[model samples]
Target: MTPVLDPDTSLWHVIALEVQRQRIAHDLSVTQLATRLRVDRSTVSRIEHGWRKLSPEQADGLDAMWDLQHLFRRLVRFAAATDDGNWFTGLMDFEKEASLHRMWEALLVPGLLQTPDYARAMISTKSADVEAGLETRLARQASVFDGERAPRVSVILNWAAIEQCVGGRDVMRGQLAHLLEMGERPNVNIRVMERDAGAHVGLDGSFRLLTISDREIAYSASPERGRLVLEASDVHDYAVRYDLISNLASPVGASRRLIEQALEA
Candidate 1:
């Protein structure tokens, strides 16, 4: 039995399958389709396998070649623009699929790195069912951090987020210890923004920049709502903001020392 592709999880997979289907229906070989799209045959294969996304130029070429009057173009546009509003389904999909994740958190530890107790303390106050919420939060970490090919993650954590005790001394100490362990992983980098750094763009809120397939996405969250940003320009701005905030953060070694100091304090 063939498994079904979930469009909500990855619109790229849906688009890829559709392009392959269109090519087959038109009796075009992969090489021939590549020629039409002005991309390499490997590019075509990558697109079909959902390892790569169709660029706007490739989308336009497909529409022109098929004379389908912008069918592919519209799919690409919609895929880039699609978001799930408050549900954050789209944001979660991006987090799972992204090859690289860059995050800046001002008020608390990012969910991807939160400890179970810390997550419970945070989630319990805002929502019902602490056990269910804690389970879900831990599941999210497993998906993103425990994968065979875990994504490279770089985090800029505000020092205040560490000093502010959420779950009590034991919980805070455990969380900081966890952070140190995670930082030791080759794929993870943790940099701390000292509380004294005083006033920066990241102070506006917490956000993430995710690099997935051929594009970058930005996600910003408020109390109960989140937004997935796909506009190239907007995503670029987030990238730039991340760079600026990173400038204010301690180096990885220094950050580790800071965490250790906090742990001993």
Candidate 2:
């Protein structure tokens, strides 16, 4: 049965429903389809209900089962080409299958390690719709611990990010401590670009590089609008810019010291 459309149904949901239709049209039951896809029945149900995203492998399995090899390949290509929807939703989907994440933040603490207070302050300051914003941000943070394989993440923050004092000294202290804890993880690297480091490409804004298999997609945020995902030549240019910014940024050791100094101040 086709699921009723709800305001919350995303593009992923539409795609999932299409897959289900094809399966049923081919006389395949949910269990048979799940077995063919090598995923649990609940996984199939979640994907259909838009409660979960399909990995590239799972998408491929469904494509083959539904005799949609060409269309499935195209959908996967589109998924790889862009970072997808809302910022938080896109982050969850990207992190799920990414092998590496390259990030830069100019004005605020990166979301992954933000304390509740800091996150609250950020949302309150920026979001016109605070209630929805808070829920989305919190949900995004929760996804970091969901998957079995976490991506290797490298984040570069502007020194100004530490000095801003978003939620006051005590909150800043908690945030700095959180950063220190997160940096100690074997798969994560954090760096800070000093204020007087001279001009750099990242001065424009913050952006992310998400590596899915052999392809890398880029996303940037705008103050007036929302997020924009980059592809092809645009992704390549942002990558070059990111590399230049990283080069100008302080080394990890110095960055940690900078954070410590900010916390003390």
Candidate 3:
């Protein structure tokens, strides 16, 4: 089943056609193609239908095997940068579709990891439509808890996020308790970066990395500068920062203990 390729808004469809055209050029059937590429037949189907976005590895592998002149990689990036306005809207869409969601939150609790009360308190300061924004933020958490097929979630939290009482003691108590519950999920890994993990790469600020199919995009911001960076270089830079923070963070067990300790205090 082939879908119409809207070339303007759908550079992703352009990639699908390029992959299909090249596969047929080589006279390989879907099953044959999957066998030859060592990927699942379903993967090929999804790519052809634009139902799944390609990772850089998948794109590069296809390029090397089929000689597609690197057009595949360029198109994948173009698709990621499709929307210029409402960065959060683009991010929410990405979060919904991403196979993996990861973040190094330096100052405040991440939305997906926040309790409704904590989120309400945090948003109250900036969001004019507090009720709608709170609902949207809470809804986003659904991505992390969708049964066994839920996206993998890894959150590295700065110790300050736990210590600060964003919505006073009762709200923080709920938030920490919620984190403890989320951390126990098989697909969720929560780590804490201690205050003494000073002079780390994450010292710059907080950022989120979403892995869609195989490619990853990152969002980072500060009061002075904020951006949704789509380039491989931008993603690569965050990955490096993430690694450094992870290395210094408390182990999962220790992180949970820290949360428990904070709850008691």
Return the TM-score for each candidate structure. 0.70, 0.69, 0.69
Error of 3 at 79 (Å): 8.9
Which candidate number would show the highest TM-score if scored against the true structure? 1
For residues 10-81, could you state the per-residue lDDT of candidate 1 as single tens digits? 767778898989999999999999887777899998888777889989999888888887768756765775
> Candidate 2 at 253: error in angstroms?
0.9
| Candidate 1 residue spans exceeding 4 A from truth | 1-87
Q: What is the per-residue lDDT of model 2 for residues 34-127, given as tens digits with 9 covering 90 to 100?
A: 8888778998887777677667787776666666645555455444444443354454566666788899999888877688888888888877
Give the C-alpha lDDT of model 2: 0.76
lDDT of 1: 0.86
The CA lDDT of each predicted structure is 0.86, 0.76, 0.82
The positional error of residue 219 in candidate 3, measured at the CA in angstroms, is: 1.2
Clashing pairs in 1: none
Between the candidate structures 1 and 2, which one is better when assessed by TM-score?
1
